[model samples]
Structures are given as C-alpha cells and as structure tokens.
Target: MQIFGITSQELFGQLLLGLINGSFYAVLSLGLAVIFGLLNIINFSHGALYMLGAFLALLGLNHLGMNYWVALLVAPAVVGVLGVLVERLMLRHLYKLDHLYGLLLTFGLALVAEGSMRYFFGISGETYPVPEALQGGADLGFMFMPLYRGWVVVASLTVCFGTWYLIERTPLGATLRAATERPQLVQALGINVPVLVTATYAVGVALAGFAGVLAAPVVQVNPLMGSNLIIVVFAVVVIGGMGSILGSIVTGIALGIVEGLTKVIYPEASGVVIFVIMIVVLLVRPAGLFGKQA
Candidate 1:
C-alpha cells in the first residue's frame, strides 16, 4: 500500500505533522490579522510577544508552581495586560503616522524583547513536559497520533473560528468595524474609541500569547523561537491577504499542508514553497485571496 513511492503510513504521518504545524500557523496569523485589520498596525513584535507567552508559561511553571492549564489562561492575560500598556503608552501615539513607522517600532521592540530573553535565558532551548493527561499517543490505524498534537489542531481551529464569529457576526464586531472606519462618528455615539482600540490591540497580542503557550510543550522553548517562525507567519498573512481574518486562517493551514507535502515530494523545496505561493498569489491577486480590491 504505497502512493507516490511512499508507504501509506509515511504519507499519513506527514499529513498529520503538517496539520499540527498548520494549527500553529492559523493561530499566529489570526493574531496578525486581528491587529492589522482592526488597528492597522504591522505588529512586527507579534513573534516576540509569542515568545514572551511561552517564557511566561515556563517561568510560571518553574517559579510560580503553575500548571499547563493555568498557564494557558494566566500567560495570555499577563501578556494582554502588557499589550494594553504598550498600546496606551506607545502604539497610540503612532496611529496617525506612516505604517512604516509602526512597523519599525514594533520590529525594534521585537529585537529588544528577544535580546533581553536571550541575555537572561541563553540561546539554548528548554523542554516543557506535556501535561499529564495529554502525554500519550493513540493508535490511529494508519499512524500513532499524539494526543497533544490532536489537541493543538482542535484548539487552534476553535480559537480561529470563534474569533471570526466574534468579529464578523456579533453587534460588538459591528461596533468595532464602525469604530475603525469612523472613530469620530462612533465616538459621537458615546463609544470610547481609544479604549476600544487599546483593547483590540491587547486581544491581538493575547492571541499570540495563547499560541505560544500551546506550542510550548511541542517545541523547544527558547528565546529565538518566535523570530524563527514569524517570517513564515507573515508570509501566511500576506498570502491570505492583509487584514483578512478568514483568509489568514485558511491560508495558514493550507500552506502548512502544502509545505508538508512538498517535504515528502521534494525535501529541498519544502522550505521555500510558501514563499513561492506568496509570489504567485501576489502577482495574480494583489489584494489577496479574500481581500477586497481597493
């Protein structure tokens, strides 16, 4: 039972791996989409914030005696609060400036965050043990599946769609959209537009934190973790279309699978496949797959 000169088990296994990777992609890109869509910030610091979340989880477990479940909640909340401070103190002042200014600021912030973490923790990675309940694997006929990997996919999808629903279907979402488009008009209606903006940024960064926590057990928790993945995430966001929530989610997952398949078919091409797709998409649809043409 082989297809494309590979055994069924091998193919299925790679697919599963791809799906797990896709899960991370979806969550990270969702955060990027949220920030760019709502606040128009490039958020180059997103990867750093993600690394912060993982470190918070690690530190909380080591110093505060917190568990994975607790860290899942607490890490994101702490990061979200930090995000609020960043927004109120820094990002708010740049709202009227060129997008490049915001990008540069966040990029510098990312470098600072990474540098501080590296200085304190060193570049070596640390392992985070999987939670007790999810520490095993299940036999899935074709392959053995790790419970944690399955959880990552399920959890990522839930968060991604839940976010989409929140921002697309609810009255709150409508208000948010209105505020972004016409802050003065929404303010006339007694909405605290600035607060909303700040909160939105917090939520965006919090999503990144949440993703980091989820990824901690699966990958080596290191200071350089975020920097390594952020470029790919940005590629996902662009391929999905800048500021398109659903686009980011779908494109991230799809590209992950594509990358995985490429690994099986041509190992050398796997790393650059997403970039190639991005190039093709850009040439064809400058607005992205889901973006509206301006």
Candidate 2:
C-alpha cells in the first residue's frame, strides 16, 4: 500500500540522496557562476579551494575548538582573503589577455594546491563528525530520512536563493553587474570597479569555502575531494551555461534529481547520464538551456 499507490523505497532513497547531492551542486555551481560572470575567469582552482575550506574547518574543529557554525563563517573569510590575494597578485594581471591564460593559470593553481595537500596528508581521507544537533533521522511512512539531509536541503536553498536576491535585486548588485560589463564606464561613475572585482572574486571563493564547511560531514575531507567533484560540477555549469546563477541552481538540483531517478531505474548508466545529457544538449543547444544565443 503506497502513499499514492506508487511506492519504491529504493527510488525514494535515491531521491533523498540526490537532493543531498543537489545541495552541493547548487552551492558549488553558484560559486562557479559567480566567478565566471563577475570575474570573467574559469577559476579552475575552485575545487581545490573548496577542499581547502573543508580542511580548514576540520582544523578549526580539531585544533581550535571552533564550532561548525563558526568555521562555516570563518573558513570562507580565510579562503576569500586568499582569493583576494591571488586576484590582486596574479589574476588581475591577465584580465587584458585572452581568457585562456586565466584558465591555465587557475588550472596550475589547482594542481599546485592538490599536490601540496597530497604531500602533507597522503590521501587517506579524514572524517568529520556530524554536528550533534543534526545526528538523527525522521521516519516517514515509507522510509526514514536523515535529519541532516533535510537541514542541508533547507540551508542550501536559502543560501542559493539569498545569493540570487543579493546579486539580482540589490543596488550593490547593479554596481557589480555594471562593473563586469563596463569597467571603464562604471569607474567613470565613481564606483571602484577593480575593488569590486576583487571583492567579487573573494565572495565567490567564500561561497565555495562555505560549501566545503557544509559538506565536510558528508564527504571525505581529503585533498582529492575538490578535484573529484569539480568535473561533475563543470558539467553542471556547462549544461546550465556559464555566468547564470539561477540556471546553475536550477540545473544542479534538477539534474541531481534526474540522476537520482536514473540510478533507481537504470543503475549502470547512472554515472555517465549527466554527461550524456550534456553532450546531447551541446548538439541541440550550443549555448545551453540558459546561455545567451549568438
């Protein structure tokens, strides 16, 4: 006797799992979109930066007795400041050149970051304890879902949409968008476009760092964690179209659900299904579902 006459626990479980994945995707893709749209760089270091955030949070918890809530806020600040330093010292210089150089530089940064972490940590992976407040489960009629997952879904949605509001409806956002499209003109209007650029990059990286804090309990906190998710995230970004925050958020969550459903119905194809859709979308809609058409 199913709730609506159609009941499959395995499928339901997969969806719950997918939604959790979606939360990560939403936050990560949002970060990617923020950097791409505002800073005009691929930010290949994004994944590594995320891992760094997770590691930082772990360090905070273990060494400094910092709570997850505190680490969530602080890690982003720390990572974001580093992002500012990178932009100020290196990324800012490549703005006038072809976008490829920025991409390559970020890729190099990713490699360096991953390598350094691997050297220090040896890739065994570390565990992050779940916050005590979220260590329970809710029993639905059909299945039991973890409370932590529900927390993740709610918190992630809030952050994603909150960011959307901040960037789309606010006066500060107008300056940011204007800065991205016409720095010279915006600068003429008395907004420090370069400062805004630096701030934007910092903010984007901070978002990634925040995501890492949220994800620490779910995934292994290893140096390789960032590289692992970055590929799928890039696919999400590609399908959603770069520089589109809403698109990324929607696509990431929707695709996660689709992937969840596929895993229940077609187990073997689950891994590559998103990529397959991506290829098909590329052929059918070169600019992607939300990208601007030529």
Candidate 3:
C-alpha cells in the first residue's frame, strides 16, 4: 500500500503514533482549560497531579498486584477524591482573591506532591508493564499499530469529546457556564454554586488522573514526568485560547503529531517547535485556532 510513493504503512504508522500522543495532550489540556475557564486559576499543580496518578497506579501494581484495568479504576478515584479535598480545603479560599494567588498556591502544592513522590519513589523513573491482553499489534493493511497505543488514542479522544459535549451541549453544562459567569445569581436560585465549582475541579483533575493511568504503559511514570511535559501543555492551552474546550483538544493533538513529525525530520528542533508554534499563533490570533476572546 503506497500513496505518492510514500508507503501508506509508514505514514499511517507515524500518524497513528501522533494521534495517540495528541490524545493525551488533548485530554490533559482540556483539564487545564476547564480550570482556567471556570476557576480562573492556571492550575500549576496539574502536572504534579498527573504524576501522582501514575505513581498511584504503580503503587496499586506493586503492593497489591493490581493490573492495568484495576489500576485504571482505582487510581483516578483516589486522585479525584484528593482533588475534591484540595478544592474544599485549599482552592475554596483562593476563589475570592487574585488569580495569581491561586496559581502560586497550586504551584506550591505541585512542589509538595512531586517532592513527596521523589522522597518515596526516589528521583529515578519507574516502568509500567503492559498487560498480556494488549501486548500485540493490529494489522490494518496500511499499518500495524500496537493495541495498547491505539486504545490510548481512542480512549483519550472519547473522553475529551464526551466532556466537551457534556459541557457545551447539555443543560447541566449551561448551568455550569452560567455559574462561572455569575455565581451569585446562580446561588440565588438555590443551587450550590460553590459545590458545583468544586465538583468541576475534581472532574477535571480526575480526567488528568485517567490520562496518567493510560499514559503509564506508553511513557515512563516518574516524579519528574509532570515538569517534563507540563510546559508544553500550558503552551497548548495558550495556543488554543483556553476559551474553548474544542480548541484545546484539537490543538493539543495536532501539535503532538507536528512534534512527532519534526522528530522524523529535524530532531533537534522538535523540542522547541511547540513553543515556536505557540508564539506564531499568539501573534496571528491571540484567541487561538478555535477560541473566542472574552
């Protein structure tokens, strides 16, 4: 199978890998975008939270012999519960202050979480094993893609789009949006606006947790993982304008593949390409590819 003399197999292979990477980015950025949109907080701890998810999954595996499927169920719930506790105890206080304070607080929280993991797990990274069930490749005529990797791509996209649809096209989503814009008005209607806000934050963090669990098999689970990839995610959110969920999802996946393709060509430039794209996008359309300025 060849197209334009470029083997369809090779092209599709890279594209598939790119889409997998993009799915993680999309979901991760979606979490960031949600926090930014409603809480007006940058969530500097997002990367830390993500690392925590993977670490927690590793713990489930090592101590309890839990496999990927069980870890997938357990890890996110634990992390999400932690998120809700943080919201009730920490973020709730910052909601009335300057956004920078929230950023600083979350930054400190990230440091605490990452440092604790390093203390226990050591600074060295840990590996996550693939289950026997997802250990083979699927031949699709044009490409032979790994089952685990393909699942990661599909699952991430499903979660990302599902969240978007829930938020953008549902009655509950309408109320959530309204609450973000005018909390007092929504509260006056007898809705627990603060509780709703906290729930949204927890949901966003849980999505991050899910990403971490899914990512364990594909990437090394490490204390430093968050710091390693967070800046790129932040750039993705910025480039997508953080004003639109769809923008974040699309831009994240597109940029990931763009980076992957760059790796195939000029490997040296791959590291900085995302930031370069960010700068270009900001200069041309500060609102981002699918965003609208407030």
Candidate with best TM-score: 1
Tens-place lDDT per residue, model 2, 199-251, is 99999999889889989998889999999989999899889988989989999
lDDT of each: 0.94, 0.90, 0.87
Q: Which candidate number would show the highest lDDT if scored against the true structure? A: 1
* Best of the two (1, 2) by TM-score: 1
Candidate 1 C-alpha error for residue 104, in Å? 0.3
Instruction: Give the per-residue Cα lDDT of candidate 1 at 284.
Output: 96
Candidate 3 lDDT, tens digit per residue, 1-294? 665455767667767777887888898999999888877878989998889889889989999999889988888888889999999999989888998999999999999998998888888778999888999988887678899998898888889999999999999999999998999999999999988898889988988888999999888898999888789899999998875788899999999899877765676998899999999999999888887865
What does candidate 1's lDDT look like per residue over 176-209, in tens digits? 9899989999999999999899888999999999
**lDDT score, candidate 3, position 211:** 90
Q: Which candidate would rank higher by TM-score, 2 or 3?
A: 2
Clash pairs detected, candidate 3: none
Candidate 3's displacement at residue 222, Å, is 1.2
- Tell me the lDDT of model 3 at 223: 92
TM-score of each candidate structure, all chains considered together: 0.99, 0.96, 0.94
Clashing pairs in 1: none
